[model samples]
Every structure is written in C-alpha cells, then in structure tokens.
Target chain A: MAKSRVLVVGTGGIGTMAAYALEKGGLAEATAVMRSNYDAAIKNGIDIDSVQWGQVKAWRPTAITKNVPDVSKGDVAPFDYILVTTKNIPDVPPTVADIISPAVTPGKTAIVLSQNGINIEKPLIARFPTTPVISSVAYTGATETAHAKIYNDDPDCQKIGAFTSPQVPAATAAEAAKRYVNIYNPTGTLDVLYDADVAKVRWRKIAYNGSMNPIASILRMDTPRMRMSRHIIDDLIIPIILEVRAIAEASGVTLQSDLVDVVIHQDPSDTGFKPSMCQDLEKGNLMEIENLVGEPVREAERLGVPAPTLKIVYGILKGLQLRVKEEKGLWEAKFQSGNSYE
Target chain B: MAKSRVLVVGTGGIGTMAAYALEKGGLAEATAVMRSNYDAAIKNGIDIDSVQWGQVKAWRPTAITKNVPDVSKGDVAPFDYILVTTKNIPDVPPTVADIISPAVTPGKTAIVLSQNGINIEKPLIARFPTTPVISSVAYTGATETAHAKIYNDDPDCQKIGAFTSPQVPAATAAEAAKRYVNIYNPTGTLDVLYDADVAKVRWRKIAYNGSMNPIASILRMDTPRMRMSRHIIDDLIIPIILEVRAIAEASGVTLQSDLVDVVIHQDPSDTGFKPSMCQDLEKGNLMEIENLVGEPVREAERLGVPAPTLKIVYGILKGLQLRVKEEKGLWEAKFQSGNSYE
Candidate 1:
C-alpha cells in the first residue's frame, strides 16, 4: 500500500514536533503547514536536520504555507490525516476550518486536535460533522526558541483517542494508535493510551493547566518556584483548583487527582520547566484566560458553586491584560510621535 | 506670643513636608527627629535652604537622631505636637511607638499621624491614652530628592483633622486644628475639616489606597496607565473598592462614594501620580498589603460580606511576595556559593 500522506498544521513548537515524530515513525509522509511562508521554509529545514537516524541517514518531510494550492487539482495529494497543533486563539479554529475543509475527504481523512483546553473538540465537530475528528492530549513538552528551532523537552509521549457521538470504530482507532505508537516509538519513546475516558484526561490536563499556568503567568514565576511556595499553593493554586474541579464535576468530567497534590508533589528542582501560559504571557501574546479560568468560573456560577478564588484570579489576570494593552497604546503613541519628529 | 515649639517625628516625606509648612506658616519653631543621624543632618540642612523668612529660619530648630543627646532638659520646653510620618509596614507601629514615647507629655503634647491606612489610630491611641493622638490624612504628594531640597507635587494643599475617639474635647481639638491649620497653611496650604465624620474620610482614603496601590504594585504599572485601563478597574480596582466598602460598612464607617468612580473617573492626566505601592514593589520593599487589602478583606469576610475579588487579588499579591522571597533565597544561595569560592 502507498504511504498515507499527512498534513501537520501549524509550525509552532507542537506542530514542528508532531511532523518530526510522524516522519521518524514512518507512519506517513508528512508535510508541515505553517501560516507564514518564511516559517514554513524554516520548519522544513529543521525537519531535514531531524532526518539523520541512529548510525544511518533518514527521510525529510515537505513544508507548505497556508497558500498551498488545492489538492484536488493535483497541486498536492490529499492527506489521510490533518494534525492541528496551533493555539486555540480566536482566529485559529475558523482559520483551520477554512483551510482543512477542501483537503478533507470524509471517511478517508482524519483531523486530530492536539491543542490545550476543553470545549474546542465539540465546536470543531459541529463545524465538520462528517469528518472524523480525533481529540488528543499531548504530554510531551516541545519548546520553540529564537530562529524558529524546535526542541522537545519530553522526547516522546502522546495520548490520542476519538471523542465523538457514534464514535469511530474501536478496531480502526486501535489500528491508528498502533501505527502512531510504532512510528514514534524509536527506542521505545512513545506511549499510546487508548483512553475511553478522554474527557477525564482532558479535564485532568485542564486542571493542571488552570492551576499552574495562570498563577505562573500572573506572578511571572516559573513552575518550580510556584510549586515550592506554600503561599502560592494555599492562596492562589489550591482555591483555583478546587473551583476548576467543581466546574469539571458539573460538566460531567471527573478529574483524576486534586490540583494541590499535583503541584506539591511535582518536583521543585525542575526549575527549567515553565508553564506554557507563562511563555505566552512573557511574549505579551493573547492568553487563554477566558477558556482556562473564566469559562470554569462562569460555569461554577451557573452551577451555584461559590468559586470566589477563581473569580478573583480571573479578574486580576484580566486586569493585567488591560494594563498591558494600555501600555502598548502609550508606547505606540510615543513611537508615532517620535516618527513624526523624525 | 512666642511660637509653640513643634517636633516632627519620623522625618520622611510627610514629616519634612509638615516641618516645611509649619515653619513657613510662622506658627511653630519646627524640629525634625529621624531614625538615623544622617537623615537628621540631611533634613536640617534641607530646612535651612528652603525656609522662607530669616526670623524663624535662623531658628534651625533641632535635628536629632535617636542617639542624639537628650536636649529636652528641665528648663527647655517639650514640643507641643509630635507629627509622626513613619511607614505603615509591620515594623513601623512598634518602632514609632518606642521612638515617640519619650516625646509624649499628657497635657502639653499631642501626636499627629500623617500616614496612610486606617488601623494605626486605634493602636497609637491605645498605647498613649493620656496623650492626644490625632489621625490626619494627607492629600498632596512629596518626593525627597536631595539632602537640601524637597519637591512637592501639590504644595498648595494639605489636610489635617482630629480623627480619634474619647474625642479630644471639641474645643481643644478645634483649637489644635486651628493651630495646625495656621502653621501648615503656608499661603493657606492646609484645609482643616472638623466634622464628626472623620472615620468616613479615613475609610474613603483607605478605599482609594486599597484599590489603586496594590494593583499598581502587582502590575508594576504607573497610575495613569492603571487608571486608564478598564481591565484593571474592572478586575482589580472595583472589586478591591467593593471589598473596602464592605469592610468599612462592617466597621460602621460610612464611606463617601463608591471607590469604582474614584478609580475609573479620576483624571489620570492631572496627578502625574504613581502609587507608593508600585514604588515598594519595584524596590522589593515589604508591601503594606496586609494592612491595605488583607486586613480589610478579612474584616469583610468576618462580617459575612463576600469579598471574593479582594481575596483573590490579595492571594496573587501574597503569591508574588512569596515568589520574590524565593528569588531572594536563590540569590543568597548563589552569593554564599560565590563567597565560599572566594
């Protein structure tokens, strides 16, 4: 059988890592789709660097920008799977929907979402009902540094499964998992868990993200220091976790562990680890505050669960966002004035 | 009549300002008492440069540090008023109490607190019951730049009043107010209000301080940007103000207006103000968070008024404090390591 063609969307840390892993696993011939043409070229070059295998040379994948020609017109072949690893910002989902609609052949293609947070899966499924959409939880940490180089903090581990009504066939899902495991499991690197309780997994991830990310971001502290500080655990993290858990329970998702336990038990010596939310905050990028903290707090209010802690933190984070916006405005004004003087 | 001798204790911004105003208004011969010998000498030199008339100006009053000789001998008279302007940290009240105890004389002397916050009046009054303790609110701004120069942001105004219990006999309080108004009203700079609603005034000031200061500290943003940012107002300031109001209401003090209007509607263009809290945060000095937000929120909670917003911002601020502590520890460890190497 001909090798299945795969299109990995987004050339960020996660997207680049996924493409690299897929090509190394030999499951499919992958092409990374980046938003910028410059980024696409850079990402393709990095894929080429990852091609050198153990004591032998290996394969390289193609890179395509968002402006890639139609697959039906023979410009590029149809992809068997479209993996999206972009941040679920306001424009991302719709952008993905528009780009992937023409490339998707229902029943023949699968689109996997490996982004953060919950509630995204349902919306995408609603948008493309016929297309097989797989919800994925990535445990690995992939960091993108300056000059667009991708480094995998966690070498290999991913949890992928189907999350839908009239769920995809178990046999087919298992086969897909096996294929992924085999491809990425060089030197036994990837662990594939076929979780029927994917919602639980998603909520568990959300709990961790919700607790650590915002606290780290707002405080501008790394995860280890945040974990080590009892003040942070008692004051910010624990209350937020309890509130998030309440929201999860109300939404029918059972998170596996309590947030405080996870934070306290997590090693403080892992000083190199920064929550992704902190990375976004440092970059002055738009945060997932609404989805991470706001949505759960809003839900808790609807459920009549008193989430005072979450409400306050959400307000603070929102306040910081506004302050940053105002500063940017002032900076822009000054910059324009300077330009006029020049 | 000879000018009543006055000693300005805790010669920081407020203390120095009071001294300058008092001398300029020709109501008192003003002496400054500072914690350090350097500060006393510096402040004395500053007063010499800035004094308006050469009559009281030649009376360089006294500039004495704690270790200075006991100048108040048998024939030498004690100061009529001791104006205390110490910082509102945990160490402040005890330190100030110890320093000014010797200066307190039952009928002849009174202590005026020209500092920020609400709780200091009760403690000082309790400590020195026989001596009059007047709580005064300063509305103007001052910054100390040099040993011989002090800059006033709003030199045209200062407010002084008797805000204490077992009410300093109305006649005595009014006379004291008039005396203070005369002395600190250089070119009529002071505004003295002698209403029974002093608690309300203090609470209103507390509301403004609690709302603007801590958030400014946390975000490291200046007043104009913070006030202009709707996010900060909605997320941080308003909630904090609400918390303050709730606490004030619980304490039976009627606040003048909703704090939100004060923060949101306050003209940012006029003041060129940056909150003292931000200055403390930038300097990594101990913040007045406990007194400003924590104490009020705790009071509100004790009163069964939900201060969710205040609690969260307080938590985050506390968290930031802890993070700073950890960083300090790390820096100390690194320094110790370097010392060992040396």
Candidate 2:
C-alpha cells in the first residue's frame, strides 16, 4: 500500500506534535504548513521537550510549505487527512475551514478538527459536504513556549470519530475514522481511539470547556485559584456546569450525574494550569469564544433550556473580545436601526 | 447661631467637594480627615479647577485632622454631622461606620452616608441606634487627578433623605433629613433635595450601580464603548436592570416604569465615563461590591425574586475582588468542609 499523505494546517504546538506522531508511525508522510514561524521551522526544525517523547532535538516533518494552495499545484497525491490544530475563533474572517479549503479534495480528503470547541466541524462540513469529516477531542498539554520550541508535558491522547451527514454515509465515515486512527496510532501507544459517537464526547468535553474556560478567563484565574474560591466554585462554576449539562441533555446527550464534581476536581487542587481562554486574554490574543461559548449559548436558546449563566458569561466574553479587537484595531461599529450601542 | 460643625471622614474628590461646597455656603464649618494626602492637604490645601466654580486655588477646610479620634480629643463641642464619604467596602475589616464611631455622638450627630451604594446606611444606623442616619447619593463629576489637585466638571447635585429605623421616629428622621438638605444646600443652587422615600431613591440608583458599574468593570469599557456594544447593553445591561427592578418591586419599592430607559440614557452616548467600580478595578483598589451587588443579591434571594443576572454578576465581581485581594496579599484561605473549591 502507498504511504498515506497528511497535511497539517496550523504549525502550533499541537500541529507540530501531530506531525511528529504521524511521521513516527511510519505509515504517513506529514507536510507541515508554517506561516509565522516558517523561517525558524524550515532552518532549525522544531525543538520539542515532551514528557511522552523526551528530548526531540530539531525534529522536522517530511515536507514543509508556506501556503495551502501550493500543496496541490504540483504532481502530488491527495492528502488522506488534513488536521486543523488552530485556535477556534470563528468571529474573525478567513476561518480555519476557509484557510484549508484550497487543499481539500472533495470526497477524498478527510478533514479532522483537532481543536478545543463544540460545533467546530460545521463550517468544514458545510464547505465540503461530500468530504468525510472527523470530529476529534485532544487531551494533550502542548504549548510553543518560544519560536520553534515546543513543550508538551501531558501524554498524547485523543478520541476521534466520524461526523456523518446526508452526503457522507455512516459506514464511509466510520471507515475514514478507523483509517486515520490506525495511521496516526500505528505504534498503538498514542492512544488514538475511534469513538462511535463523537457528539457525546464533544458534549462531555464541553461540560468543562463551556464552563471552566470562560469563567477562568473572565476571572483571570488559574485552576488552583479557582478551586480555592469557595464562592466561585459553588455559585459561578457549578451553576455554569449545570447549565451546560442541561443544554447537553436537552440536545439528547445525557452527561454523567456526578459530572459537575468531576469537572471541579478534574485537575489536582494545586495545579496552576490556566485555561487557553485565560491565557489568550492575558496575552491579548483572540479567544475561542464563538465556538466554545457562543454556539452553545445559541443552542441552549434554541432548545429552550434556561442558561442564564451561559448567557451572562457569553456576553462578558464577547465584551472582552471587543476590547482585544479594539486594541488590535479590528473593531468596526456596525450600526442598525440608528442605535450605536448595538 | 454658630455655624454647624461637620467632620468629613474621607478626603477624596467627593468629600473635598462637599467640604468646599459647605464652606462656600458659609453655613457649616468643615473639617477634613486626610490619611495619605494629609501632608499635601495641610501644607498646600487643595488646588481646584472647576467648571462650575472656575479656578479656586489652595482651598482648605476649617480644620484638617489626621485621625478620627483626634477630632474629638480637644475641648470642642460635639460634631453636628459626621459625613462618611468613604468607599463602602463592608467586607474589609474596620468598616466606615466603625472608623467614624469614635467621633459620632449618639442622638446628637447625624451620620451622612454620601457614598455610592444601596443599603449603606444600615451599618451606620446599626452602630448608632438613636442617631439619625442620612442616605445621600452624589451626582457630581469629580476626580483627583493629582495629589491635592481636584477637578470638578459637572454641577454638584445630590439627594438627601433620612434612613428611618425602629429606634428613630419618622418625625425625628424627617427633621434630620430637612436639616441636612438645608445645610448641604444653603445656596439652594446645589441640587440637594429632601426625598420622602429614601429607599425608593436607593433602588433607583442601584438600577445603574448594580448593573452598569460592575459590567463596565468586568468588560473594562467606558460608558461610550459600553453604549456602543449593543450586545452588552441589550443582553447584559438591560437584563440586569430588569432584574434589579424585579428585586426592588419585591422589596415594596415601586421604581418608575421608565427607570430602565432612564438609566440607559442617563449619560450621553459619546461620554467616556468610567464608574467608580471600574476605576477601582483599574487602580487595584477595593471595590464597593458587598453593598452595591452583594446586598441586592441577598435581598433578591430573601424576597424570592429570580435574579439570575444579579447572582452571576455578583459572583464575577466577588471573583474579581478576590484577585485584587490576592494581589494585595489580603486573602485568607478559610477552610470549612472537605472541599477547597468552596
């Protein structure tokens, strides 16, 4: 069998780690798409110090390209899987799907959404209806501390399954999921499992992302400080978890009963782990607000589930995003019906 | 008759303006209690650049005392009124009422709470049972841009009313309210009017402080930017105002039907006004969260009013306060049960 061809969209920590894993599996050739760190990555490769894979000095993928469209120009085979590991900020233009659309081959290329958010695959599925879409949830702790320097302390583990639609049949979607899992986990030590119901896993993951991420961002607190605040844990965090759980249940996904407590104690009490949203706010970067909080809030509204906590939280996150946009000169006042406040 | 003797507790902008106004009226002898600004105030008095009263330099009160106990040490008659113009942060030790208790003569001194908050008079009234309590809301644009330098742009206006209690009769409370309005507005040009129902005024004021103040602090946006964000005004601010109105109604305070609209448009849309709480958060100072949002939330709970907005806003404000406290090294981890996330 010919070796599978894989394209990685974002060259952040996750993308770099995923490319390394696919290349180490020996069944796939990984081409990393680098934008900002292209010079450093092409010259020095990537220096990774990970707990799972220790002391990887200057690891480089099979191929490197500056743009996505450049990949499909020459005589090249179709990419079997294109993993999008970018931040899921949907409000900004040229979304992840749009950026990766140029390289996707309809009905051939399976797109994997390896990001932190719910409803992240909708845009890709809408753009390429016949293409097999894979929904994935990653549980690795990977970060690029400096240019081309990656630090991944946590183990590499992820759950991926097919996102079926009318255009893609269930069997085909399942086959695509199984093929990508096998290609990405040839050593079987990467813990890349094929989940039958990815939506359930997404909802279960949202029980934390939808609650803790935004709360920590709003409060500018890490996990340990948040856990130390009794009033916050009981009043704000728990109620928000219940709201997310209620919305999940209304959408036909029943989260575990003790899910609230589990989410609270998921991390150890002393871990000073800051959520991505909190870090984004601190760094004045755009956050994954729309997919992580906004979409679920709209879903709750549509499902008639009372999500007061979600609404207030989404409103706050939106306001914070506006501040970031204003600082970056990206905010435009869109007026409607003669009201400026809108 | 001799001029009425008054001691102003806080020498901030409001207190300074109050002293200036009282002395300008020539009906009260004002003594300002200064802490950090005591040296500057005593040596140079205060520099004023005002839109109402243009360019009055080095304006000093009758007497400047460093401490409250020192004011009552000499062979001086008891103070007729003790104006507690301090920030109303009750959660911190040695509250405003406690600090001013040494100079307060029970049944002789009228305690004035010229501060921003709802239910501020409760503490003072509790400290002095027979003493008349006055609740005053300030509506002036004043800020101390530098040490001993004051800037007052807007006209000085306030509403003075008696906070009646079981120990103080309505007639006596009414007399105290009338006497305060008279003394505070001797020129009759300063818009200090007597309000018969002071609780109604407080609830009306809270429709703004309890909503806009905290929301702006959380979002870090001024009035203009907040008014520009339609989502914030329509989704967050308006909903919070409605919640406050509901809580007020449950407490038998019939706020005006157009109170919400009035609160929204009270400030012009183009003005860049930052509320006190917003300023406090930016300057890393203790905010008036306990009285401004906490008390109203407790009231909503007590009256069976569904105030989800208030509850969530209060929780966020508490978390922010914790951040400030931690920065100042004032937070204590009080463990109750087994869980620390409390």
Candidate 3:
C-alpha cells in the first residue's frame, strides 16, 4: 500500500515538530506548507534542537510547498490528513480554516486541529461539514528560536480524539483519529494517546489556559511570579478556575473537583516560564483571546452560568488585544472629542 | 486676626496647585514641604501657567521647607490645616500620614486629605484620633512640566467634607471643614464647595476611578480609547461599576442608579486622557491600589457582598503592583523550584 500522505498547514514550532515526528515514524509522507520560511526551509531544511529527539540537522519533510493549493496541482494524490498547528486567534481574519480550505479534498481528508484553547474545532467543523475532524491537544515546549531553527525543551505528547459529527459516525471519526495517531506514532517514541472524549480534555486544559495565560499577560508576570503571589493564586487564579469549571459544567463537561488546586500549582514556582499569551503581548502579536477566553465567556452567558471572573478576564484581554491590533496596524481606533459626563 | 497658617504635605501636581491656591487666596499663610523638588522649587519657585489663573512666574508660597519636621524647628505658629495632595498609594511604607505626622499638632491642626480613593482618611484618623479629619476631593488637570514649572489646564475645584468621629463632634469636624474651605476659597477664584457627605462623594468618584483608572493602565489605553470600546464599556466598565455599587451599598453607601451609564459616558471619546493610575504605571510609580480598589473589595468581603468583578480587578492590579514594586526595588519576590503538581 502507498504510504499515508499528510499535509501540515502551519509550520510553526508545533507543526514542524509534528511533521518531523510523522516523517521520522517512517509510516507517512509529510509535506510542510511554509510561507515566509519557504526559501530558507527549501534551501537549508529545518534545524531542530530538541530535548526529546536530540539534535536533527537540516531535516526536511517528504515535500515542501509554499502554498497549500500548490501541493494539489498537477496529478497529485489527495492528502489523507491536514493538521493545523497555528495560533488559534479567531479574532483575526483569514482564519486557519480559511487558509487551509483551498487544499482540503472535502470528505476524503481528515482535518486535525492541534492547538490551544477549547472549542477550536468549531471553525473547522463549520467549514468542512462532512469531513472527519480530529481534535488534538498538543503539549510540547517547542519554539522557533530563529529562522528555520527550532528549539524544543519538552517531550512531544498529544492527546488525540475525534470530534463526532452527525455527518461522520462516531466509529468512522474514531477510526480516522486512530489512523492518524498510528501514522504519527508508529515508532512509539512520541507519547501520543487516544482520548475517547477530547472535548473533556480541552475543558480541563482551558481551566489552566483560561486562568494563567491572560492573567500572566495582563500582570506581565511569568509563572514563578504568579505562583509566588498569594493573592493572585487565591483571589484571581482560583476564582478563574472555578469560573472555568462552572462554564464547563454548564456546557455539560463536569471538571474534576480538585481542578482549582491542580491549576494553581500546575507550574513549578521556579519555572519562570512565560505563557504563549504573555509572549504574544510582549511581542505585540495578536493574542488567542477569542477562542480561549471570549468564546468561553459567551458560552457561559448563553448557558446562564455566572462567569463574572471569566467575563472580566475576557473584557481585559479584548481591550489589550485591541491595543495590540491598533499598534500592529491590523485595526484602527475611532474616537470623537466631547464631554465625558453630561 | 492673624492669617491661618496651612502646611501642604504632598507637593505633587495636586499639592502644588492647592498650595498655590491657598497662597493666592491671601487669607492663609501657605507653606509647601518639597522633598525632592525643594532645591528647584526654592531656586525657581513654581512657575504657574494656569488656565484659571494666568501666567505667574516664580510664584512662591509664604514659606518653602525641605522637610516637614524642619517647618516646626524654629519659633513658628502651628499649622491650622495640613493639606495632603500626594498619590494615595498606601501600600508603600511611610504613608503620607506618617510623613506629615512630625508637623501635625493633634488637636490644633485639622488634617485635610485631598487625595483619591474612599477610605483614605482611615489612616489619618488612626494616626491622629483627636484631630478633626477633613476629607476633600480635588479635581484639576495639573502637572509639573519641568523643574518647578507648573502647568494647570483644568480649573481647581474641591468638594470638602468632614470625617465625623466619636472623638470629635460632627459640629466641630464640620466647622473645621468649613473653615478650611473658607480660607482656600476666600476670593472665590477656586471653586471649593462644602459637601455634607464626602464619603458618598468619594464612592461616586471611585465609580470612575476604580473602573477607568485600572482598566486604562491594564489596557494601556487613554480615556478616549476606553470609551470607544463598546465591549469594554458594557462588559468591563459597567460590570465594575455595578460591583463598586454593591460594595458601596454593602458598606452603607447607596450609589446612584444611572452610575453605570454615567461611568460608561464619563469621558469624551476624544479626551484621550490617561487616568493617574495609568500614568503611574507608565512612569513605573507605585499605584494607589490599597485605597482605590483594595479597600472596597475587602469591605465587600467583610460585608458578605460578592464583588467578583472588583476582586478580579484587584487581583490583576495587585500582581502588576508587585511588578512595579520589584522594578522600583521596593519589594523582592521569593520563589522555589519544585514539581508544580504532585
């Protein structure tokens, strides 16, 4: 049988690592879609210095395409799976779903979403009604230190499950998810586990992300400083955890009772790690606010759950996101001169 | 009759203006205590470029003292009133009350608090239990552009009231408050009015300060930008206003009904004004967290009022305050290296 073909849409830290893992497994042919880094990657390939896999010099995937649509032209075989590992910023236009839609062969391709935040599969599910959606939660301290140079400190572990739709039967979706995991984890080096309910896993993950990410960004503190502040842990972090739990419960996902304790102490006090959201703000990049905090707050409101903590957190992140957008020239602020109070 | 001698403690923008006003009134002998700005203020005086009171070069008070203690060294009459116009950052050590305590004559001199926040007088009342505590809310757009070069855009107006205590009769406290206003507004050039309930007035002011000041600082937005963000107004600002109202009500002060709308539209869209707290953050100065947001939240908790929004806001601001303190070497953070979760 021909090798299973995979198209990775985003070649950021997570995408590059996932593609590298799939190719290293020697079960599937992986093609990376590099936009700006295409020339560098095509010429030099990717230099990955990872703790889990050691140093791999100038490693290239089976093929490299500048654009997604370019890979589909001229009698090419259809891709079995298209994995998206971009930042889940739904607030920005030309979302990941739209960007990867050109190459998707509707029902033939399984769309795998490996990113942060809860409800990230909604857009992909909306765009591809009949296609199987693989919901994935990727955990790896991977980052691109320089152009075409990746640095990963943590092991690549992914919790994989299928987003069951009425169009795709549970058995079919699960089979698709299992197949993708099998191709990526053939060597069993990467700890990729199949989860029966990825949505519950996402809720658990967001309990940490929804609390720590935005708060760390807003406070301008790293993990160590945040954990050190007693008020932050008790007053802010715990409340947000409780709020997330309420939101999850309202959405029919009952989080663990010890979830607050789990989240408060998730990072070691000396870790001093800055969350991705915090790094985004520091670099003036658009944050993953909409999916991480905004949607959850809106869902809470829709479900009649009192998510005051989340609402305030979302409000603050939204304002900060606007400032970032305005600074980056992605959005403009409109104001008129008049009296403040009448 | 001898002129009423008044010593102004904090000579920041507001303190400088108050001293200028009291000296300009010609009914009181105003003495300004300049700590860091003493040399420049004594050498150049305060060059006033006022919108209300036109340009006055080298405007000196009745006296200029380097330290509050020095003002009482020689054969000098006691100060009838000590007006404090510094930032209400009670979190920092050597509070304004403590700094001005050396020159205070407990029973003879009435301590006037012309600063921000609700329970600011608590410290003063605690320090000088027998002394009458006069609470005043000052509104002015004033800044020191250069060394001792003062700029006043908005007119100086103050709502004066007395903090009635069992130690001091309401009539005596009210009489002291009225007397200070009379001295400060003898010529009526300054719009100083007497308020029967300054606590209520402080609550109303905090509806703006508590919502706008911290949010602007956190978002790095000016007033105009804040008002233009509809979600910020509806979700963050209004909810904070409601929380402040709940806190105020639980503390025995009922806020107005249209407070949310009032706070929402308080600043004109084109004002582009950065509240004092925002400016403090920009300049890396300590914020007035204790009195402005901290006290209210604590009061709410004590009174069993659920101030979720305020608590979250306070939590965020507290963390940021830690950052500022760390930057300024006012505090040190301690962290330990261990497993985050067991």
Q: Flag regions of model 3 displaced more than 4 Å.
A: A70-74, A340-342, B70-74, B250-257, B340-342
How do all the candidates rank in terms of DockQ, highest first? 3, 2, 1
What is the per-residue lDDT of model 1 for residues B1-342, given as tens digits with 9 covering 90 to 100? 778777777665566767766775676877776554345455455533322322222224444444312435554467788887767665223556666777666678777877777666676667776566666777655655545345555533445667554646766765676566666664553454344456677777778777778777777766666655555676667777877887888889767664566545543544445688778778776677766777777777778887777777777777666655555562222211111111
Better of 2 and 3 by DockQ: 3
TM-score of 3: 0.96
What DockQ results do all the predictions give, each relative to the true complex?
0.29, 0.49, 0.63
Model 1 compared with the native: what TM-score? 0.82
The lDDT for every candidate, in the order shown, is: 0.64, 0.86, 0.85
Write the residue-wise lDDT of candidate 2 on A1-342 in tens digits: 888889998888888889998889899999888888888988998999999889999888998888885446756667888988988888988898789877898867899989876778788778898999898799888889988899998888899999866789889989999999999998787777989888788988888898889999999888778888888888888888898899989988888889998898776564567888899999999999998889889999999999999889999999999999988889964423332443
Worst 10 residues of 3 chain B by lDDT: B333-342
Worst 10 residues of 1 chain B by lDDT: B333-342
Rank all candidate structures by their lDDT, best first, as comma-separated numbers.
Answer: 2, 3, 1
Q: For model 3, give the TM-score of chain B.
A: 0.95
DockQ of structure 2: 0.49
Q: Highest lDDT among the candidates is held by which one?
A: 2
